[model samples]
Target: MSPLQKIGAFGAALAVSFGAAYGVGALVGPFDSGSKSEAKQSAHQGAGHQEADAESETEGAASPVVPAGLQVTEGGYSLDLATTALVADRAGEVRFTVRGKDGAPVTSYRVEHEKELHLIVASRDLTEYRHLHPTRAADGTWSAPVTLEEAGSYRVFADFTPAGAAKNLTLGSDLTVTGAYAARQAPEPVREVTVDGYTVRLDGELVAGKGSELGFTVSRAGRPVALEPYLGANGHLVALRTGDLAYLHVHPHDDKAGATKVAFTADVPSTGSYRLFLDFKADGKVRTAAFTAGTDQHAHG
Candidate 1:
């Protein structure tokens, strides 16, 4: 089945909103190993998926802006993956370049979150995730060292902004790992999870199509622990949809330099299960806490 077919009508609407949020023309297929040209053409072909009447609706929390990491190319820029496959359980370098509409490597980029680009890798099953900062070379090619513990299909996202662009863009592609593959189920929803002797509890709810503020407190031994800054904020969050792994744009709110609790705001496009990954620094070391959350459809203001 095609990607749009799998997403169904409701998902297609959300996908349309995602493309529109960035002022793009169409929504492309999910992560695949297809060529960039093929994917771009497929996306334009699907542009008619959106109904003419839906255009009048306000593009706010009601529409739910589902941004980036779904298409390899968007808004005149494309993610060119030089390394598409990697070996399982082995450390290797992944290389790629950002090409503009003029078909030349884009070397100049605006720095955001203390880095020019942020790379995210997650398994198709949403079970494995990683956040890496890649170094850009003089030729505009970005390279990063990564190791995949398991063999499976993974989605690679390049989140960055070209010089003079209005906003950041996330381009996604597929990476294959050769070996025996076994899929794992997403964990059940939980309000609290423990990681590395720290207990992280999630407060607030995720309501679909509404801007939700999520608060997370880090504690150990029944006492709140102060958290240092990570990526220009007290904490960082990356939430992915359960089935298709749609990457949600999470904005971390700024707080005191070293506060015990950090907050974020995110708008999910639809009602479904999502996996939330929280990255925070404490005791001078960075740690990630993962949790599963679902939207409460009935909770609408």
Candidate 2:
């Protein structure tokens, strides 16, 4: 199964578990309602179930689901390229077509984040990455030419919301790039810092050869505050390797407010210095946090 499939499966399991728990709680509640103790227990149980269901639904609903029957076909919504396999190539072209869920031809799509659909391609090792926006063709195909100077296993993500849909979605696929192999190394430990009167804490170290999860918590006056949505997602994070500004586009785990926090899983190709930019809405205004991260050549520090 693909990584996307794995994520979908996990989400489905969580939803099912939440629903099952609610059903069990409701079934047991009526058995002993006459006793005051039983009534208190039932009330607490019901509230717990409701909260769980709400959270499950919110996460499931926000995720983008790729409908069945969509595939790469001849003259269809397919990616056409000289080589789907790449490695340290200075330049290449990715040509693809877009169709409606019903297989009907689609002419255009609304731009999200200043583009029709933002394409984020990155190596699995977190070394090489690129952010590009493709142009729509007359026939409904979107094409974007890219260039890479680093070698690694790359994944391409299409981030966009279907027209009329209330939420944004991310679709992912993997591509292989060939060249000299270099194992990713670990970076320094996470540290707490302050930015623009806001206290923020980073919770993960950077690694060069593998994906790393970086988490951030935002607080003001020693109390957590809700973070409003910026763009279509709850928060926006961008990472750039200091030398060349290699781009890494990361997404938040959830969108709800109250206690601002966002997590991003990213890969870096080589041991180097990287700059992270985090933007979120707080105090009725957009706030950005900047940090310099370093990845070491050894174990995760």
Top candidate, metric TM-score? 1
Residue 85 alpha-carbon offset, candidate 1, angstroms: 0.9
Residue 24 shift from truth in candidate 2, angstroms: 45
lDDT of 2 by residue, 182-204 (tens): 76632332455555677767666
Worst 10-residue lDDT window, candidate 1 = 18-27
Global CA lDDT computed for model 1 = 0.64
Q: Residues 56-144, candidate 1: write the lDDT tens digits.
A: 13655243334457788877889999999999989888899999999899998766556677788888877777777888899999998
Taking all chains together, each candidate's TM-score versus the true structure is 0.77, 0.43
CA-lDDT, candidates in order? 0.64, 0.47
